[model samples]
Target: MTPITEVEGRRLALSNLQKVLYPATGFTKGEVLHYYATVADALLPHLRDRALSFLRYPDGPDGQVFFAKNVPPGTPEWVTTARVPRSDGPARMVVVQDLASLVWAANLVTEFHTPQWVVQEPEIADRLVLDLDPGAPATVVECCEVAVWLRERLAADGIEAYPKTSGSKGLHLLAAVRGASSERVTEYAKRLAVEAEEAMPGLVVHRMTRSLRPGKVFVDWSQNAARKTTAAPYTLRARAEPAVSAPVTWDEVARCRSADPLAFLAADIAPRLQDHGDLLAPVLDADRAGSVP
Candidate 1:
């Protein structure tokens, strides 16, 4: 029988507690649950009311992986859901609003993803994320240079941006926005990508062509769309180790001499959380938002 525990009045049957999801480090499923519980306070606010998607690795990171947008069968009745219109019809996605739901989902998935808009207002965007992915020859060390440039450029336009490691292999620069639709934000993000490319030729590339990304930082601007989702801040990435999509300080980003400086593992979270409770917190305040310029 699976061990049952109650979290905020919801009963959850946790399975495979000793199952290692990350064979590289022997990180177990139980540790994954614990990590989410530890960071729930800071993570829930970002996930609240947002439609979630996940990449599940039932057989660990090196095994088969599948992307899931629709909530799988047997999801608890307590889990809030939203039916969003898609090309094939309406698909139901999980909307994790509480600690219980987050833990339940964390137990089963390797990564957590959320869109820029909330379920209550799917058409409106609350944040804009610029995904700065480094190409093979260009590492995240190089992306930091681009992020610093983008920050100053955004600051000039009165938008305050925060930096975070992608947890995969890049940097995600996020800024809060008020009353803007995803379409408008997407366009604005695209424009920034183009401008960044022009300003730093050969360093930044806005185009999505596979070959163009070889030695440049691909400034991905399309994730700002209502339908697309980004890896939620604090979410664990399914890498060789249990690395997290960690919120970072500008000081760290600017002084990053190598990729090692920016990389953060799951164990590093609690300490940072204690020192700086949710470095991404400012992006949550709607009042602190800047217009999509």
Candidate 2:
């Protein structure tokens, strides 16, 4: 029988601690929990008050996976949850507000921690997200180039944007907004994507069509929608290698053009946090101003 691990005074029944989740790196479930716990101080701030959708892999990265919207039944009452309204109906979503909750979620093998753009309210969006996904042969290098272009454009409009590695072969740029309506943000993002595509002809694709993707980076503006969720920064991706959705500086983003796409991994996050702190911290500053108004 697996013994319960005590973290921050919380007794969690952790199982398969030695089970390798990332076969390539031989990263175990215990390591995953440790990573979350070590980074909780920086990570929980981003997740606080946000509705989280869990992508669980019970049997590690090689096994079948499922996403849990509503906190699974039998969740401890001490763990926080928020009632969020969806198209079909209102669903209760887990809100990771503390270290205990974060560790608990990690115990569930929640590899991808996706959170809504809005906070507690479903209508208000606090940030604008731009997901730059490169199709085959395009590579993250193209995504980096496109991101720099977008960042400069936003800067010209007096907006400050934060960039991060998507933990996979993509990049995510986010900017703090004044709790704007999701529809407004979505429209604004779509228009910006179109404008970017126009500015860089062969480099950017605004639409979601797959065939149009090859050799082009897809500017996924659709992530701004109210129902849409993006992988929270610092969350580990469910890949053969334990890569994390690490927040990066603009300088790092620029350098990534010539570096490996998987440069940032689970092992790299702690050292980064120690050296640079949270690069995305400004995204949570409610008073910070910058938008395409």
Candidate 3:
């Protein structure tokens, strides 16, 4: 058994990931491993490859473990690592001094890929995301109401929308549409955003400028293209509470307390990967008529 120290934790995490990851269908371990390795190296290079998440340091052809000596004392769970995966080579293993260093580094990984397997493919379907954010004054209760309404409307259109916690403080409603080109996807997204705004009247906004609409839920269309990604389904965001995007049936939207979007953890994610296969498969089918509305 691997010890649960930071170093061991990451290794164990990788091992635990393998258990569910290996069973994921459509894409085999080779594909997933390649993705995992690629994403870890290219996107989340700040994470070390030890007890929590795998971190690889290029030491010419060989690699090195990472450690941190500058981490301050008394850090939280998410802040344990320091060194991220470097884009350049000459990597080596080093100890991360404490938990604080690790967590701080993870925040830099907001730009990584959303793994090709987790989303519905772009060719078969376009995703129109309604990112609902309730400000500090906004309760999760209010968000649930909007979710309930959104679910019914989408179902009536013969569209399937999946709900996930935004890993922050809101809800992300992902509706799968037929795959189209980026322009097509944007157009579809715009139409959907218009419809959603009209349907809700006051609750949802269709603007992308955050500064313009400080406390409003904007219909984010940017997540629809190739190379663009959202946080993977069920990925744990760095938060104290057990905030995760707990998967919910469309009918269950009203039952949740709030849409704080932080209902998932890394542990909760693996099983989903195993059971659902990649959520993107249907999107990849690319039969235009079958995909488009």
True-vs-predicted CA distance for residue 276, candidate 3, Å: 11
Model 2 global lDDT (CA atoms, 0 to 1): 0.84
Relative to the unseen true structure, what is the C-alpha lDDT of residue 227 in candidate 3, on a scale of 0 to 100? 36
Tens digit per residue, CA lDDT, model 2, 45-113:
898888888888877778988888888887878888888878789888888888888988888988555
Error of 1 at 59 (Å): 1.5
Residue pairs with backbone overlap in model 2: none
Cα RMSD to the true fold for all candidates:
1.0, 1.5, 13.3
Top-TM-score candidate index: 1
Tens-digit lDDT string for candidate 3 (242-267): 23344544444566664333355444
lDDT of each: 0.91, 0.84, 0.44
Over 1-293, each residue of candidate 1 has an lDDT whose tens digit, in order, gives: 89999999999999999999888889998999999999999999999988889988877788888888998889999999998765577889999999999988987765889899887788899899999999998999889999999999888878999999999889999999987899999999999999999999989999999889988999999999888899999999878899999999999998999889899998999999999999999999888899986
Order of candidate numbers by lDDT, starting with the best:
1, 2, 3
Off by over 4 Å in 1: none
Find the candidate with the highest lDDT and give its number.
1
